[model samples]
Target: MANAHMRKKEPDKVRRSLLDRTAKLAVDQGPAAITIQAVATAAGVTKGGLLHHFANKQALLEAVFADLLKQLTDEIDRYMAEDPQPFGRFTRAYVRAAFADHKLGVRSPWAALSVTMVADPGMRRLWSDWLDGHLAAHRATDDTPLLEIVRLAADGVWMADLMGQDRAEPRDMTGLEPQLLALASRPPSA
Candidate 1:
């Protein structure tokens, strides 16, 4: 009975290990390499063990993508908590968190999950829905061009960072942040 109880707790660890292996494979060899056997091998688990945690490749990919989204949302929440502004908190938080993640290194989990998301339509939809929901929450309260511009600029910076383009020339965006924050704080012109 005690052994059964202990076994129940082990699945979560196994699942996490499988997900980490999938992300590493995606980062090293792209999404196509994320087969069940590949992930199981990478994780040092048998194929049957991997399947016990994730029924199939799609399930595994979905789990990884979902985990990524949760991490991003949590990071954004942390950043938003630091800033008291009500109007642009979400966008600002998103920008700050994304840039921070970029600095974590090139093979960040977010980048690996991005590759998987792009390769799988279902994963992409999951990301799109989360993004749309976040934008809707902000747009419902404030519909301003400046806010949109800030969102776009932040997205551009994030994309550039994700693609490692910024490393080529090292364009600094620190000066632009305060300016964008000021614009986000301004009352929308009637």
Candidate 2:
């Protein structure tokens, strides 16, 4: 019983440490440098120690992505909790967070890691599935073009940043926040 409990606790600690290391690597040098050995070294662990928790580099990267997804999901949750009346508040918060200061906020990790998907379709699929689920859950209330537009606009901003576009201006998202709130808060079509 003691050994089992220690095994459980130790793995969680190692897993968290590896994730923190990977996120730092991702932010610093981008996800392309996120390797099992690299993360192990960064986390002050041996490769075998990292492998004990992740089994492989792909698994570690997935955990990194999972960590980012959870953060974004939690952000959404907190925003929703503040105003549970209509889902618009959730949507508005998303836009504000996404484009606030013309930056992707904490979601910058997702954009950085997204490039790795070209080398790993499974990672791409995982992200796609998560996005699909979110859309489906909102489809009923969204039930119209407004939600689709928001999704597209949000994606456009990301893509623009990814492509290094030099638009008229970065985005001025702060100015657009109120417009997004108005659109999302409007009563759904009868």
Candidate 3:
């Protein structure tokens, strides 16, 4: 029977799909585009189905933000895992991930959410919380002013690219990572 091949509905799968679509919408249309009707249409699910997974639009937005942050933290961890050196390691990984995310163009949730993160206090608080956690964890290695400057520079470059600034792209500048990593690699002054 044609109907026999159909798989049973899975809530987890459906929920993940909804989240993925929400991120995509944010990437394509900014956070303001994220609504119950819009996300449902994007996810190809019924309004009721989307609501089942997310009780409201605000809940859906928070879930999307959480999902994006998880993906970012995982990438940072992955990058950190590959580097043997402890000094400037997190900064290096963040630089790489920031530039790499930019290359993904409109599909990268960070690109769209950057503005929202700055515009919305709740989103900004989440971002600040993430930074606070990482800062606490890496204080031993990343407490120096030099490391802080490097991190701030990386943030600037990332936001610049997102804002469509000419010549803001790291790839276009040539050896940007090497330069940033060079600074990050230097040991803190005694």
Candidate 4:
């Protein structure tokens, strides 16, 4: 059943704004800043309005995490579509997407979502479930040691950025993507 919020004009627009604001807040202030009142003010909505869209802060956080995952999924799919190779295609696409997604703004909310994800067990489960399913789906092509290593390397870079351990200057990592792609271009070396 739908609610009054769903029946309003451009309700999805409002909902998206709320989610975006929530992600921004998460990145800027950490998970503790995702309160309903703060999210409402960030979205330029009333507490009642925010509540109408999201039952509670938890619900809103779940929705935001889910939305961010959806965006990443779409990005990976886009990269796969453009890729010319078959073997390790998924791995290659994932590396490009993950590195590209680490940016702070311009629709990139991974760092923020990652912070919230670490604090919430349920959200972590959501991520694990999604990752398990995705990896299982791509296992045929991405199971090789080379591809796995490449993917893990990409993860390491992203993780470093997430932990504020190292600045991810793409230029500094020059030729890195090509090297990964070249490795991904091969079949099982094992």
> Clashes per prediction?
0, 0, 0, 0
What are the per-residue Cα lDDT tens digits for candidate 2 across 26-109?
A: 867888788887898888777878888887888888888878877877876777677766655556556655564246543466
lDDT of 4 at 32: 78
**lDDT string, candidate 1, 11-66, tens digits:** 77888999888888887777778899889878767788888888888999898988
Worst 10 residues of 1 by lDDT: 1-10
Model 3 Cα lDDT, one tens digit per residue, 1-190: 2342374777898899999988888877778888899888776678887998998987787788888888889999999999899988888888888778767766778887777778877788788898899888988878888888888988877776777733444346345767988898898777
- Could you estimate the TM-score for every candidate? 0.81, 0.80, 0.87, 0.82
Regarding TM-score, does 2 or 3 come out ahead?
Answer: 3
In terms of TM-score, the best-performing candidate is 3
**Which lDDT values do the candidates have, in the order given?**
0.76, 0.70, 0.80, 0.80
Return the lDDT, model 3, position 171. Answer: 42
| lDDT (tens digit, per residue) of candidate 4 on 67-115 | 8888889989999999877789899998888778655432456776676
Compare candidates 1 and 3 on lDDT and give the better one.
Answer: 3
Against the correct fold, how does model 3 do in TM-score? 0.87
Clashing pairs in 3: none
RMSD of 4: 4.2
| lDDT at residue 26 of model 2 (Cα atoms) | 85
lDDT of 4: 0.80
